[model samples]
Target: MPRLPRADRAADAALLAGLTVADPQAAAAFVRRFQGAVYGLALSITRDPGLAEDVSQEAFVKAWRAASTYDVRRASVLTWLLTITRNTAIDAVRSRRPVPMGAELLDQLIEDSLRSPDLAESAVHRLETERAIAHLHHLSPDQARAVVLAVIGGCTAAEVSQREHIPLGTAKTRIRDGLRRLRAAYAGGDLEVDHG
Candidate 1:
């Protein structure tokens, strides 16, 4: 029988079923169909393009391995694949030793975002994100580093302490105080400058 078109859930299920059975065409089709979304989610979670690419590859491998467990009634193929991508990306992030994220790094990211042709509407969203990141500069360097490590790097308090070579309590205090200040600044709308 001829195959159905590639855009619908049923077709997605077929592609996954084909992948489970080790069909090369199905595997190729599946990757071609979802690579963008998979990579996008991975990049968003990991925030590093190189690591995101690695995570994306791992997610696809995992999906291929666990293809038999996919259930259409529970979720769509895209959702299932993206979940694997997210988990993989988070794992990658957690496994790495987090370094301090400074204003220079944030500025470079913003500059890269501004230059991307893909930033059509996301430019506004990216600007908002840049604004929030810029607010980190208002913090003392140590507090800012602590907050970035704990929040953006997804490090636990103990991990932060270990990385920063500080006491756990101090790391927690920094994160807490930094967040409190940021909250106040955001609420008061006092931090309008990008400072990059």
Candidate 2:
């Protein structure tokens, strides 16, 4: 086995900056440099070459869309891109699996998880769920509903828009803002929920 050469961090960062502005040459170069690694990771996670190809493409698209949000202080370009690939692969795999529970059943499960403490093996999961639910309650009603439909229901933003009778952008904003609040609150320990 041979060790791969170290990444040129400055060059990669410049490529990502160019990608943020839709520079075609930078996009091509970035893809060329990372496609093999991205596809390899996707294939390992998805275990399907065709799905891996799709995941790899989607991961690159997501990277392009999110390029402006990339933080050099947080991670190198390769590490950040691989994280996107990993998440995209997981989402692609999850989408293929059928959820056994219907909406009512899912709602019931959430309710039970919150109120019942007797499920000894899942105590940690239940606590996390409880905390999440508490944070959801803190969001505006519209934001909370949008987040729930898209996240818990696994519905897309378009679906949430249709269900909520709002524009697509509005639905996306609600979900994004809701999640941002939850993340901030969780990170800052600002949630007023009783964890005990």
Candidate 3:
């Protein structure tokens, strides 16, 4: 799906805020606006329509709970929602007991193969991801470490600082600085940007 531009994103933020205030029709409008993306992400992760529906509902519930903390400056609404969906799905997957390697692993392997037909294609994707990660390395070591923990490991900045034995402000600075460098690298043509 194509991404919404900045204007649409701001409009979405406003819509969500209105919904939070319990506008009679705001909830319907909010669902109409985001349901497709939410369901699509859930389906992608869960691979089951029923499970996706459940996860989508749960994600929206979580989003509603966290509405007051939504910061448009940090991430778009869609990104934030999808992050919640993805984390929830990952948690769901992890919660399941490990099964024998036969059917499940084989299915996953087949899915991965179908997703990337050839080693070259997979390699290219990996290379691009690595290059983006390398741009993080251009930051100061502490900053790079914080960014890595938050972005790559999916930890919050506070978690990153705790894990790294650093102050919270330091962690925030590192993450912010690292992200700045990453954006600069992308804008300066030093890093290839992939919209996907």
- C-alpha TM-scores of all predictions: 0.49, 0.47, 0.51
The candidate maximizing TM-score is 3
- Candidate 1: tens digits of C-alpha lDDT, residues 73-189: 655677678768867876787678355344455444434433333455244334544555667777777787777666555567886788778999999998898887777775565
Report lDDT per candidate. Answer: 0.71, 0.72, 0.64
Regions of model 3 farther than 4 Å from truth = 1-10, 99-196
Question: Candidate 3 residues 160-191, lDDT tens each?
Answer: 67776889888888788668767678556464
Q: Top model by lDDT, which number?
A: 2
Runs off by more than 4 Å, candidate 2: 1-10, 99-196
Query: Which portions of model 1 miss their true places by more than 4 Å?
Result: 1-10, 98-196
The local lDDT score (0 to 100) that residue 76 gets in candidate 2 is 64
Candidate 2 lDDT tens digits, 55-139: 9999999999999999887656776787788778768867886642245644543444234334452433345446667787777
TM-score of 1: 0.49
